[model samples]
Target: MLIDRYNSQLLMVDVQERLAPAIADIAGVEAQIAILLRTAREMAVPVIISEQYRKGLGGTLPSLAGLMPGVQPIEKMEFSCFANADLQAALSGNPGNATILCGIEAHVCVLQTALEMRAAGRLVFVVADAVGSRRPESRSVALDRMRMAGIDVVTTEMVLFEWLRSAAAPEFKPVSQLIR
Candidate 1:
């Protein structure tokens, strides 16, 4: 299914300062996420960010956090964002039913969150290139598991183009420039 800009929200899981360094190819993941964030902003897609144990993990990376000024990151002890009341409340408040996910530790937080969101009957899409774990193997397994469970695993470009739909879209040029 195409990701309609008006019907979807972006959920960035724990891509914290302390946690990011441990993820494999995190720089690449972060780059992809940056593209998504830029596209989401241009398309007016709502964004929800979660930080697991802010005290320990620090906060979202300064570079990434800068991209989202004025947006508060929800703090949670729960691996799955759905399990945290605050995050759940934030998500519930949004009108969008489809969620685009990206973050660290694909096998843990990202994976669990995707599964739970799917279970809740919401359309969930995990941006594969924007998610990672400490071990490539772990990330691979998590992607496989999520796919087996019917979650739509996608890439940043796929989402960008899908949301744009056509060159006639006002956001097409700006969003297309993001990937270049």
Candidate 2:
């Protein structure tokens, strides 16, 4: 199913400083996440970010935090954001829409979150190119697992275009320039 910008929300899960460096292809993941963040802002899709044990992992990376000024992440110790009251509360306001996930450790936090979100009956879409793990195999396995669990595994470009729907969209020219 195509993502509906009006009903969908973006969840940036545990893209922290210390943890981020350990992720394989960290640069690639960050670049895609930047695109997702920009697209979400342009499309008016609400965003909720989560940090797993910030004290240990450090806060969200400076590059990402810089893009999200004035926005604070919901800090959680749980592997799945839904397990935290604050995180769940953050999502409560934007219920019934697809949840687009992009973050680190694809085999852990991102994987667990996607499964729980799917089990809750939320249409979940995990941006494949925007998530990574310390090992490539772990990421690959997790993506396959997410797909088998009924989550839509997509890419950043797919998401941007899907949100826009058509090139005639007013933001089309600027949004398309993001890929260049």
Candidate 3:
């Protein structure tokens, strides 16, 4: 199924400072996430960001934080973001039924969150290239598990074009510039 922009929301998991450098190909993940964020903004998709134990991991990366000025990251101790009331409220408040996910330590937080969200009846899509773990094996396993649980594992570009849905879309030129 295609990702309809009007029914979708972006959920950025814990891409925190101290954890990011450890994730495999950190730069690649960040780059994909940047494109996702920029596209979300241009399309007016509501974004919900979460930070896991900000006191320890620190906040979301500075570059990502800058892209989302005035939007505070939901701080949570729960590994599964769905366990946190605030995050749940954010998801509940939004009109979106589809959630596009991006973040770190894919085996843990990202994995648990994806499974839970899918179980909760939300159509969840994990941006494969925009998610990572401290170890390549962990990431690989998480992606496989998420897919097994029926989550749509997707790439940033796939999502961008799916949301765009057409070359003639008003934001096409700007979104095209993003990938190039």
Model 1 clash tally, residue pairs: 0
Counting clashing residue pairs in each candidate, in order, gives: 0, 0, 0
Q: Which digits, one per residue and each the tens of the lDDT, describe model 1 over residues 1-180?
A: 899888889999999999999888999999999999888878888999999999999999988888888779999999999999988888777545789999988999999999998888878999999999999999999999999999999999999999989999998888888888
Compared with the true structure, the alpha-carbon lDDT of candidate 3 equals 0.93
| Tens digit per residue, CA lDDT, model 2, 1-180 | 898888889999999999988888999999999988888887888899999998899999989888878679999999998888998888767678889999988998999989988898888999999999999999999999999999999999999999999999988998899899
Cα lDDT of candidate 1 equals 0.91
Q: Of models 2 and 3, which has the larger lDDT?
A: 3
C-alpha lDDT score of every prediction, in listed order: 0.91, 0.91, 0.93
lDDT of 3 by residue, 1-180 (tens): 999999999999999999898889999999999899999999998899999999999989999989989678999999999999999889877644799999987999999999998998889999999999989999999999999999999999999999999999999999999999
Clashing pairs in 2: none
Instruction: Report how far residue 72 has shifted in candidate 3, in Å.
Output: 0.9
State the lDDT at 163 in candidate 1.
Answer: 93
RMSD of 1: 1.0
What RMSD, rounded to one decimal, does every model reach? Answer: 1.0, 0.8, 0.9
